[model samples]
Target: MVLPALMLFVAVVLIPLAMTVLLSFNDWGQYKGIEQVFILKNWREIWEDDYFLEMFLRTFRIAVLATLITALLGAPEAYILNRMQGRWKGFFLLVILGPLLISVVARTLGWALLFGGANGVVNKALMSLGVIGAPIPFMFTETGVVVALAHVMMPFMVLSVWAALQRVDPQIENAAMSLGAGHATILRRIVLPQIMPGILSGAIIVFSLSASAFATPSIIGGRRLKVAATLAYDEFLNTLNWPLGAAVAVLLLVALVLIVVGSNALIERRYAEVFR
Candidate 1:
């Protein structure tokens, strides 16, 4: 039974990945196009270039900030949603997930309109509320990309925590309350510990997705700000540098794999007793 699935995985995922990695070692020139020769030119260029360094830094920075925002906000929202009863819960859940129902491109374009220059809707609203003295730049900025990504990735965090909440025993909270434990104490000791795995899982999901995201970052960051995904896109499509693009892509894959593996190992170690 597992053999077929393993074969499918190798065929669909491993084969393509291996091909791309090999391609990254090939040579490419403007006039010569792609040459099937094994060399470190693409990898060496990425390693030595400050532009690639800054772009990768920007990519992870946005991903980290977006992950933090989702964890901070989504965890609490999940708790609240879990506590609610009846039809209202479903209605609110739908509202939370409404963004996922829409097309990513459409949602990003909507953000672009709201973030339109100094006279954008978001800026005007903030100005009217006296939140700032002047218009803040949202279009073609890292700030805009982070905000949009947080919104896009929020549902995954909420759903993960909500699933964890299901495994929690409600009687534990009541029992603690009857034993003279304060609400804060009960929450801090009992609730948060139980839900920690969920939060970590959600963080991993949001971080990985944000790091590799193309559409939202492309639309909001625009030409001014370029992350790894957009940079890879430009290399392949715009610059016609297939080997270089493949190198960027492989580097991104390696980085995410390391991060995800490290995170999973830490979570398993920390929560080993709890899970067992």
Candidate 2:
């Protein structure tokens, strides 16, 4: 049973990862077709290149911000949903799952229109309210990208935390409340501890998804903002620089792995007593 799954994992994940690592070391252009010469040039260039480094950090920052925002908003929403009764619960759950029904490209395109300049609905509404003399720039900016990414990633965060919230015993919460614990106190002391796993998992998913997202950022961010994933896409498709693109892909994979492992380790260490 386990062996077949393990074999599938190796075939689907490990082989491609190995190829990407190998390709990163050798310089190759589209027409050149892998020169087969191994060198550290790609790695060296990536390290010394300020643009690549900045884009890498920018991707990390946006991902973190999106994940944090998702947690702050999603956790409460999940809690509320968990406490709801009857048909409303199913309706809210369906609403959260609604975004998944739409194509991401279509959703992002909708955001592009909403964030558009002067003629956009948002700007027009604000202008009509006399809030600003001119339209605020959102399209092709980091703020726009972040907003769109957050919207795209919110459902995952909510669903994950909701699953965790479901496992928490209402009896424990009631007991805490009967003991004179306030709402905040019961939540912080009783509810949060049990739901930490869900929060962590959701954050991990959001961070990874947002960091690698191409459509939302590309459409909302436009040509001005460059994220690691977009940069990789440009190098591979536009510039035809296979080696550089491979290096960026590998860097992204490494960064995501480190974050996930580090988060899991921290959660396990901090919750050792609870787990035992």
TM-score of each: 0.96, 0.91
Candidate 2 local lDDT, 1-276, one digit each (tens): 799999999999999999989989997755776676789888999999898889999999989998988999999999999999999999998999999999999999998888778688888988999998998888987878888898899999999999998788899988988899999999898999888899999999999999998898888987789899999999888888888899999999998999889988988787896668
Q: All candidates: CA RMSD in angstroms? A: 1.5, 2.2
For residue 268, give model 2's deviation from the true position in Å. 0.8
Best candidate (score: lDDT): 1
Supply candidate 2's per-residue lDDT for 226: 89
lDDT of each: 0.95, 0.90
Q: Kindly list the per-residue Cα lDDT of model 1 for residues 1-276, writing each as its tens digit.
A: 899999999999999999999999999999999999999999999999999999999999999999999999999999999999999899999999998899989999999999999999999999999999899998888889998999999999999999999999999999999999998899899999999889999999999999999999999999889999999999999999999999999999999999999999988887786568
Model 2: clashing residue pairs?
A: none
* Positional deviation of residue 237's Cα in model 2 after best superposition, in angstroms: 0.8
